[model samples]
Target: MNQEPTAQEPILRIDGLSKSFGPVRAVDNVSLDIQRNEFFALLGPSGCGKTTLLRMLAGFETPGSGRILLDGTDIAPLSPEKRPLNLMFQSYALFPHMTIRKNLSYGLEMERLAKTEINHRVDEIMAVTDLTPFAERKPEQLSGGQKQRVALARSLIKRPKVLLLDEPLGALDKKLRERMQLELKRLQHEVGITFIIVTHDQEEALVMADRMAILKDGRLLQCGAPEEIYEHPADRFVANFIGVMNFISGVVTPNGSFEADGLSVPMPGAAAGPATLAIRPESIAVSMNGGGIAGSLVDAAYHGLDRVLHVKIAACETPLQVRVPAHTSADLGIGSPIHLGIDPDRCRLFPD
Candidate 1:
């Protein structure tokens, strides 16, 4: 007997989804599955279709093509209110005139849920979100973070199958935004609801997402764990997008080996052709004693726990950045001779 694989199926699946606005294609043939209770992020630069994709999932925009399957059933034809989902906007769109408690209860009130049920859910969410004390305060009275919580509490009060957030913390200061990233991740686990967030901030996506999908030019690029994509990027674009990647032009030899800056790099996956070798700043070892690849220090910057040293090599035109602990660095000035220790095994090769 054929059985439905409900147990292992992803909570949401986007199959070949695409959307176009007149002459512009906002999203193109994108497909990815999001697991149940997963903290997933839709990461990309501005105008890269992440927000458009989120809107499509929330029923705000119609897809020009493809299927949006939620729990194995297509939700494309369903209207915003009919779908079991909620969209939290970047503006933290709380009703200014309504109190925090009233704002949280608005959705339930519209659904005509029992007064008792609405009160219980609103109070419960306020307590969970630490907004209990500010329950009577209006959105104008609360701080940015507290208002953000109220908006989040309102979105979560509905207990939808999935929660879609579009740059939920974009308005907060850097410190607050970073703090809220952890808070949002913790809240997602506490409620056990699948969260799909759209953002252009790579650090936010890397810090918050259990898994993430990268989109560019309306095309799906790569999707995987933060560390997985960072450690082994699928291509050059991805390598440069996630973090600070040091790229040096190189070539694959006829013997199926690669070399960069006159130093041989063993990239087993690279074929014989022109390629670029990529290595993280921390991967290269730098020293003033001069033992490895010799280069001149172009610039150095101290960032509390670590220091980044930029070196210019004779074989490479661009300055290569090397990261080392702050304590290990000496008082080396500009144009000072330095040595870089690069392990061939640590480098990644990408074809040009």
Candidate 2:
């Protein structure tokens, strides 16, 4: 979980930003604030306008309306080169022919900085990114992770106020990508620069971002710390998008309870109306004999650390998924009688 940034002022603010292309609205009227030193992620599925929003911030794509403020000054009118920001693309776009050191110093060289100063900055960032040993290697000669480090080093060498990453670790293998997620977070903290990353991967955003904004079909759905977004999603879309969620359709009863199928659960403060109850797979406990709700195990998937069981019940149309420790229910097979235990307080109720 991330500490609340309520007391600190935002370093970057997006106010009513929007963009369109012919018949499609790529980015809607979205607004958000990113505090200094925060690892912020723009997360959503493909075609959700996350990249468009990031491009607008980088001055690569102009927004049709709204303002982008950096340090309290509107940066909407500023060109990409004029803004105190840098965008690292998914492809990295490093020169295949250039040495790692040369790639790191390319931006500073283009700025016409002194050779000595450029060398110093390059050396400093190389050490910071752990690319010092690979400085003499070319992109073609380096591993994927090594090349990524070179690209990151190049971006940081300029000392930009904010760094924008577009799927920064997309090209790496699964294991390496997972490793880089933590590295990216560490780098952000060590550099103390605002990092705004655009990614379609939910797990990536959840793992790396201190705070994240969820986008859906060009609209800003919700924004908050990773845990808040996952544990307390605002709506059906958010609940479904952030992680695996089980939704059970029900109606609020007159006596302040929710009734679904044959089961009734306490739901205080809920009005008498149709609602959807959302719960995570991990939150629902399974027992072989008796518990909260009676069900029959339909299938089970054996993951390395956990088992995902699909249990069929009369309460919902689809089988409910329950995740528990691996081999915990190894003795139980398909068609086995089971019971589900749900924590009412952990369940979220949304109007249907």
Candidate 3:
């Protein structure tokens, strides 16, 4: 999609945003517009300024220079508590002394809400997060997954305009983390509120976001839908960062194909130059007909779902990974000679 319908006003607009500490810049000239009820994510490595940008949105960090517009009004100078947003930290940060119900009601109580109002809101939040049974449970007695729900319930109880999450699932194990990803996405859709999440885990961002922004060294490298970012990455950095890729460096040929010594691969409509051709391992096809690029398999491993083959092509310095069906491993083996081919459309070209 070219862009979301922007004729409608954005719930949040950030323009020329920047933040610096001494000479070090954390966020640099970043601008973004998040639509109402959109599930947006900031994705990058640990030090790539995604967290800092999320903090700025939550009003926890002040921007050195920029304009933050919420519902068409500037909120740059507003205090964090006064802003119409809530931040869920990575640690959950639950008060150990309080019960789950108390934790959920803490924010409302601070607002000087009447006792009945607090009780009603707290019960409602408990139902939404499915923590109704564990309302009186202490943080120390809950499982990792349960604690995550408690944190989510606490932040969302107020029904803020935008909910910001900073690595909220980072504390869980692999299996639990994957499960929570689906839960979070479902909750976001059900709530119909703008959800902005900051995460270093690429899979988490891709699974949860309607669209994601990639940051690197305090710069916004690219922004697009999950499929767009994965299939047509903007550059080498994005391709390598989002997932595993087999990079082949070769000079562009006369017909817009890539030629690396004895190996020649077609690059449809690609410009002529010294370029890097990227192909995901899953996209490669192996043929027994002795066609395509000739390579000798150096290693093969069975991974339950698929068999991974590392092929070292002639005249190429690095090996290319080929994934074949798990059952096909009986036909292909280590040190076996094979030919690898990929559709021209599957190859991404980046000029050097």
Candidate 4:
């Protein structure tokens, strides 16, 4: 008899999940699978329902329809306390009167774990989160980053199968937030638990998540690894939403390329009729000599890291943006003649 390979089932599966407040659909028929040990992000703008979906998964808000399964068991009907998961709220939700030790131990006490076990777990988590020095400090006494660490240690102490974080680092400043992103990623790897984070910050989601799903109007717009989403957006909305781009509307030529105004560039893929070509500003090449599209320099912005030149091509109505090295800022001037070119393969076409 041949032995069958062991299958690793998803840690959580949400099927046909929907929720509504009156006639407004907050979470509209959302379904997703969270694989074990995967760091996934639910990312979108404010009022896009990513947070609501995360809340429903944590059992804080019940789903009106469909089911949620954890380890292949129906958990939609289960209470938050009964589920094998923990949620770190956006505000950290640490008790103002409680010390860090008490905050970390509170969950264990609720479960009525032994004192020794709770102490051991607290110590372990404290070490990992670097919270040992502030163990006895209350939330009010701790710094914003320290407080965040406490909240994280509290959540991880329970050793839940899944960890859900709702804007957990929103309280910290820019420097601290960037630092904690790497720290949190390291912590997640150390613990080896599935993490589902909900955030409106695109950079945060892209930096931390192994894979992410973009939510808009309570619907999933795209789901894939960060590189896939950045390189191959599903549509114009996703393209504009995720990063900066310069759009040029053109008609697909018989030669499989597109032309608009004075610039004719080869399109990357097949699309017919009126179409819009999207190219990243950085993809554009600018030269002072006789090459590429001829245009007049309209404006330029110096961002320290790079310089962006705005050019008005004779054949196009919209000005094209070209990003160049900051060192070239002194060489180029307004009204200076320039030429721009892009690799044929870098252009992406979308039906208008």
lDDT of 4 by residue, 1-352 (tens): 4653324667888898888988888888888888889999999999889998999989999998989999889988899999999999999999988889999999999999999999998998899888999988889998888888888889999999999999988888999999999989998999999999998888898899999998888888888888788888888887877767778887997667788777788764576689888888888887766788888899999999899888898666768888889996668889988888877777778888
Ranking, TM-score, top scorer first:
1, 2, 3, 4
TM-score of each: 0.96, 0.95, 0.94, 0.93
Model 3, range 1-352, lDDT digits (tens) per residue? 8665654788989898999878879999999888889899999998899988988988888999999999888988999989988999889999999999999999999889999999999998899888999989899999989999999999898889999999989999999999889999899989888999999999898889999999998889998899999999998999999978889888998797798868777776778889888999999998878888889999888899998889999756888988989887667767889888877778888999
Which candidate leads the pack in TM-score?
A: 1
lDDT of 1 by residue, 1-352 (tens): 5775776789999999999999999999999999999999999989999999999999999999999999989999999998899999899889998888899999999899999999999989988999899988889989988988888989999999999999998999999999999999999999999999999999999999999999998999999999998998889999999999888887898887776665776666568989988999999998566688889889999999999999898668889889999888857889988888888777788888
Q: Which parts of model 3 are misplaced by more than 4 Å?
A: 1-7
- Per residue, candidate 2 scores C-alpha lDDT tens digits across 227-329 of 9999999999999988899999999988889998867889988988999999999999887668679889999999999999999988898999999999788
Question: lDDT values of the candidates?
Answer: 0.91, 0.91, 0.89, 0.87
Q: What stretches of model 2 exceed 4 Å from their correct place?
A: 1-7
Kindly state the number of residue pairs that clash in model 2: 0
- Please give the RMSD of candidate 4 to the true structure: 2.2
As for lDDT, the candidate ahead, 2 or 4, is 2
Off by over 4 Å in 1: 1-5, 287-289
